[model samples]
Target: MGLDTPRPRAAARHPARSSPPRRSLHGLSGPPPAHERTPLIRSCHMTHRSRRQRMHPTNTPSRRADSPIESLWPHRYSGVMISIVIADDHGIVREGLKRLLEVEPEFEVCGEAKNGREVLDAVERSRPDIVVLDITMPHLGGLETLERLRNEYGDTKVILLSVHNDPTFIQSAIGLRADGYVLKDGRAEEIVTAIREVMKGGSYFSPAVAKKIVEQARSPKSKSSDPFTLLSAREREVLRLIADGLSAKEVATELSISTKTVEAHRTSLMRKLDVRKATELVRYALRHGLIEP
Candidate 1:
């Protein structure tokens, strides 16, 4: 009778139904599929490559073992070498200067010339940063060559190398805007210092030359009364050739001028120098240091 409401049929026993398996955001997976992992692998590889590049830059230069200065001051030189051209009438002198200059790691002697004409040729060919020019050379003198260089190649720096420490020579160099003047008799180091100074947008003069310049500056009478200053560059060239014993035709050939033009220059030189005969011209040239005596 307690058959009761039949005990509600003992609440029919129904097995609990299991909930559906949970799923991650990627998918129902422990490890993602190959396609899903591809982006992550690429990102990791890119990060590692960037870190390697940061550790070792491509443009870094290896240390130079040859030059202590270069190694000590790596940022000073900018890795560019200075080009130089040396011109002298003497083979021995040119060789000596070449050896002296090549000692510097930054200096490269691009070419060598035995005289003023060759100096011009070398400059045209090489376009060097500097020209070390001897004052006296056959066919064309250093001063004339410097004039041509100043007109044609304004960027090229000129340094006069000369045996003459005369104030006249110094004055002429200054007037022509020469970058430096170093006496040949001075120490070989003087030329080296001159090149360095000139490259720095400064000028250099040998101690003796400097002293002469100062002396001349102080002396009002040193205004260069020497008739040599009166002659034009062409006249000077003609005078030098005549004094060197070249005939008028030979002088014409050397100068690439007609015989009549050579004669005209000769005449002009004589008038400016107040001379009469060819012998007088030779004497004047010798006295003025135009030709080697």
Candidate 2:
């Protein structure tokens, strides 16, 4: 199925939602060309001065230090010296995220910037342990900043939290060596979970974001589809239907197969996909773009 894309039209920002797209230098509404996006990002940094946020210096070098924030985390993780900088174009979103981070003591919102330019200056001065960046900030979007940041400061870990769940976007970040990608719709607690996971040297992706990439990777266009490709043709058929929200009986009726056959196919599919339950299989199928909702 073709992916449903809601374009970033400034004019379409609903009554209670966001802003209209600014008059582009060219007087158009679409995003800037790919190459221009990078330079535009640098321009944002070049224009900013000082930055601010909820950050305070940490006493411990490793993450084992107990900060007030770490104790409050949903999961008890060693409060590492995880200095985080926030860069999003929306002030409301940035503040909300800061408040959410306060839920867990393991994270420190060291600096905040409303645009890409401010982010660059904050990075130079803050030297944070991690940077939580939004994909489309004014002056410089996330992708542009990410490319430059990775090229220059290889030490910093970047976690992108954006509305965009495009596999292309995730692959681009992964290609540039970004540490993680989380989605904006994720619960505040999951964001903290992602931060801690990345701090612990594990890569994290929001369930949705991860699914997109995994789905793309399993597409026929990819070569090493072995793990996911092992599904028998019937298994694949049943898997796709199940993920699309059909029950076993429903799937059986549709495919003209017995309920027992559907059950067996589901079992084989689960084992092959390395997923445990129906939900995980759904996630796997969603990742592979076999399902959409």
TM-score leader:
1
How well is each residue in 1-293 modelled by candidate 1, as lDDT tens digits?
56555544565478788776554432332654443332111121123345345334565544344565555544343323567899998999999999999887668888899888898888887777789999889868888888899999898899999988767677888878899999988888889889989987899999898888888879857655776655666777788899999999999999889999998888888888888999999998887788988
Task: Candidate 2: list runs displaced more than 4 Å.
Answer: 1-80, 220-293
- For model 2 the local lDDT of residue 223 reads 30
lDDT of each: 0.78, 0.67
User: How well does candidate 2 match the true structure in TM-score terms?
Assistant: 0.50
Model 1 global lDDT (CA atoms, 0 to 1):
0.78
Worst 10 residues of 2 by lDDT: 38-47
Each prediction's TM-score versus the true structure: 0.72, 0.50
Model 2, span 1-293: residue lDDT tens: 34697656577455675776664323325764443332111111321222122122233233333644445543542223356898888889999999988665556677999866678788888777678988765444566677768766677788888776655556666766778888888787777878778876898988887777778777836534345545543565577778778899998887667999999988888777788888887887667544445
